[model samples]
Target chain A: MSVLVFAETTGGGIAETSLETVAFARGLDAEVDAVVVGELPHGAAGELAEHGVRTVHHATGDAFGAYSGAAWATAVQAAAGQSRVVLAPGTPRGLEVLAHLAARLDVAMAANVVSVVPDDELVVTRQVLGGSVLEEMQLPDTPALLAVAGHAVEAAPAPAPAVGTVRELTPEVAPADLVARVVSVEPVEAVDSSGLTTASVVVGAGRGAGGPDGFGAVSELAELLGGALGVSRVVTSLGWRPHHEQIGQTGSRISPDLYIPCGISGAIQHWAGCASSKTILAINTDPEAPMVTKATYAVIGDMHEIVPAINEELRRRRG
Target chain B: MTDVLVCIKRVPDVGGEVTLTADGQGVDARHVGFTVSEHENCAVELAVQVAAATGGRATVLTLGPAEAVEQLRSALAVGCDDAVLIEVCEPGSYGPADVAREIAAVVADRGDELVLLGNDAADTGDFQVGIRLAHLLGRPVVNGVRTVAVTDGVLVARGDGVDGVETYELPLPAVATVLEGGVEPRYPSLKGRMKAKKAPIDTRAPRSAPAGSGRVRLLLPPAQPSTVDVLGEGPQAAAAVVDLLERMGVAR
Candidate 1:
């Protein structure tokens, strides 16, 4: 019952990935502990306690700078203390911290873990080759670091005992290790739009949206659905959409409740990004298009006609 | 002059339908064509460009069977000065940890000021190697670098962050994982290909494989039972589309 989870604080609260990570650790049948960097939001400890975290650990130090992978990993590793496993979400920051932790622990760290089995050996199934393949890694029977894939599971509360006790500890850091502190991270100014990653409904457009002006109906349907718009790599490459809107191996990976990809052939790269959706609805004229074959629903028609028709149906129902 | 080393892998292009081996230990690459991923190809291109400007030699390295020589040759064709193949008899035998170990040894001996790799290998798909190698060598590393350059006495690596381009400046002797963005990898010219064919490539085995081999198996993910319900067609079937949406609980 010894597992430590990094509950990454975001916007002064725990991130969804942190909660999902807590849920994942609980599933391992371990005494889950959490590391809260800043002040926990109101009722957050109770929320974590609800999910089997008995002890909340935080490091007290004014010296640790803002969001550097070096300081953060050192701080978390101090709390990790002899835990059989340490896990975090596979975000850029999380992976960086976990990598440093692995080097310190001298244990193999596995990323993009889909599932873990506590067999005779610690067996981990991970998404490899940009989610094109799944490989099983058998680790040494010892402490391990694992970064779970995004949206691998939903966050649900664990069986409650009590709200966890908060503990203050200090991490010993080598001055040299903190040399490369992240000065600042700024987001590029993006157009006003729904983000592709967290959107519940993602309507993806591909090259088959026809020409640059072919997305009118698709945009109308998206507005009606009140969802985000995603695009395939070809759409971005052709300058029809920005690269930030691309959903593929080299772009944003999304896992919406429902993904409706229009005029997309569903190449392997595009499929890798969106394959985690709860449901997929593909609209393509080609019956043999890979996207159509792999979708939950397929509309074999021009997207110009199908999208407008879908919009019309919604409008009629609303009326 | 700062020597630049770029680590590249030859992967079975996962373009169309993918198949697994009979034993399910690896991708069924027998029939599939092989090529360096765009990510790695761009890294090699960057190394060559950077080395040319700084008067450094660019070395391309890979850990795979002798067949990977073809890939090494491609890197040479595109302007890399030399190549190294850490030949392993069994493919997929060396995981990320092992690859990092072998590369780290070579870097220690060669003393390259800069090392570049694809953010993640297209086949193994692990992002740990660059960071792992950096940790071992006591050097700074920035992953997912879309652009890297030497400016103002420091190496500034810029990658797309959540916001704007996240920039990091490090002293010489650093590692970076390159992503494809600004640089489109160029094809090898006929003269360059001829030069690459005769380029000298060093072949060696890892001094000693690191401990704790963790790979148990490689297999394809279980196929989901696909039921693609045809939700009508064209504009006339809007009625059916509405019905289908309502059934899925998305449309009210």
Candidate 2:
């Protein structure tokens, strides 16, 4: 059985998550081929070959320029003619495309899958409620559609790289598929200089930050640490922070190396997003809070006092 | 005028602890209350606004046990003009495809032009229903949409993407999965609650056979062993924290 992987492109190159999905597909005990909907950067095919992809189906046209879930799914379906299982990155575009394909083919599709045991009956472990719970599921049908969650597997090249053969495939897209294509894009006003998902250090604020004005010290500390500012769902709902900056289930999932949550009680929903962090430092008045108990280091005190002191200490050390 | 339909699901409030059922097929809700997800709340609010602006009817629908009517009633209290309950006998057994197929049948029958759903199910985290329903109905769909507006028979949906704010415009009869924080959801007024108390809910049984995701069991992830070191207390702990940060190489 051959596994078909969808390689989502970024800046003309393959996305890192897509590469991770390819790595996951390589472990499936099936011959893996990949398909790219848009233009592939020169020499990127070698990267896929390094990851053990045997064939690269390149589908490029003006119709594929803009992203439409339906159109991309059409291209992927046309390229998945011989594969028994289809895999894609757990990114938004990847899930959207696979859902469309599953609907068109009248099959079940699983999203955010973390583990897959490939047998005649495929058993997979997937995240539910934003990783707070794990559900073991079986994909009993052929050509099973699965989206591999981010960081499900590490992306690495094989010991011996195989030569990747590029084959052109044309998508038989209908006019209806292009209806939801992107019409325009504009840069969003940044709440912080760095993105929360990619930041090495993240400073999170919560209800204990008091209110909208309470974030001043927290913001300063984040700036001093050169980290992004994230918030609890309560903070967002209270209109203290934008929805994009909320870190939890139904929000952006972050895996920073150092996550310092100030004045936030670590609820299960919020924990789902940051459980992958390497180290957690929780600052709260209540030492019995879930975050404080789960943190690598806990400061049982008021953040209003502790944060400014930390900022001052950092400035002194820098001097 | 375009009629708006908002799809919602009843899930555990999840404010406190989350536990699994004895069989592991569903969440154990004995310790918690139930409500729709935050994004679905925003979807209902947006639906009500769009329907009012277009002089159209705003309808809320769900596929769950009879108790899910509470969610529909809440939406009605906030100005939804209609309610639909496609009562499912085995609530958790209806997978994304089954829910979409059943919802598509209702949409086709009602001739609702615009459909809205939460970006994903809060309980199962399934992201396929909106996209699947769109495909089944042969309509354009956009997910993760935070804001939407209808003008001149075109639907303008905007959402935040990795790089920036992305906008998509589709003709009428489109679908959008909403993310919360786009608009403020209003509280139910006393009069609205009285209205909702008397409102008639259109309830029916599932017309299609069950085709659920083959869920074997639910399991909680192994807890990370945490040993918290008390890094001093009060403002005096700043020096120690700075030292730890410096030792970790995150701060100089």
TM (chain A), candidate 1 = 0.92
- TM-scores for every predicted model: 0.92, 0.96
Separate DockQ for every predicted complex:
0.55, 0.77
- Candidate 2 structure quality by residue, lDDT tens digits, A1-319: 8999999777767788898999899888778899998888987888899888889999988789878889999999999987889999988888889988998998778888999988888888999877778999898877899999888787888666667899997777899999998899887666334688889999999999888899998888889988989999999888887777889887778888899999989997898778778899999999889898889998989999999999999999899
By DockQ, the best candidate is: 2
- Candidate 2 regions exceeding 4 Å error are A191-193
> For model 1, what fraction of the real interface contacts is kept?
0.61
What are the per-residue Cα lDDT tens digits for candidate 2 across B1-252? Answer: 879999999988876557898988888988888899889999999999999999999999999999999999999999999999999877888888889989999999999999999988888877899998998898999988899999999999998775578899999889999988789899999998999999999998888788776998999988766699989899999999999999899994
Writing each residue's lDDT as its tens digit, candidate 1 over A1-319 gives 5989888766546788888888888878778898875445766776777777889887757546444566678888888878888889888777877877776566788888988997656888999877778888977635788898887787887756647888888777777566555555656666225777888788989988877888888777777777888899888767787777889887788888889999999888888899889988888899788899889887888988788878987998899
Model 1 residue A307 distance off true place after TM-score fit, in angstroms = 2.4
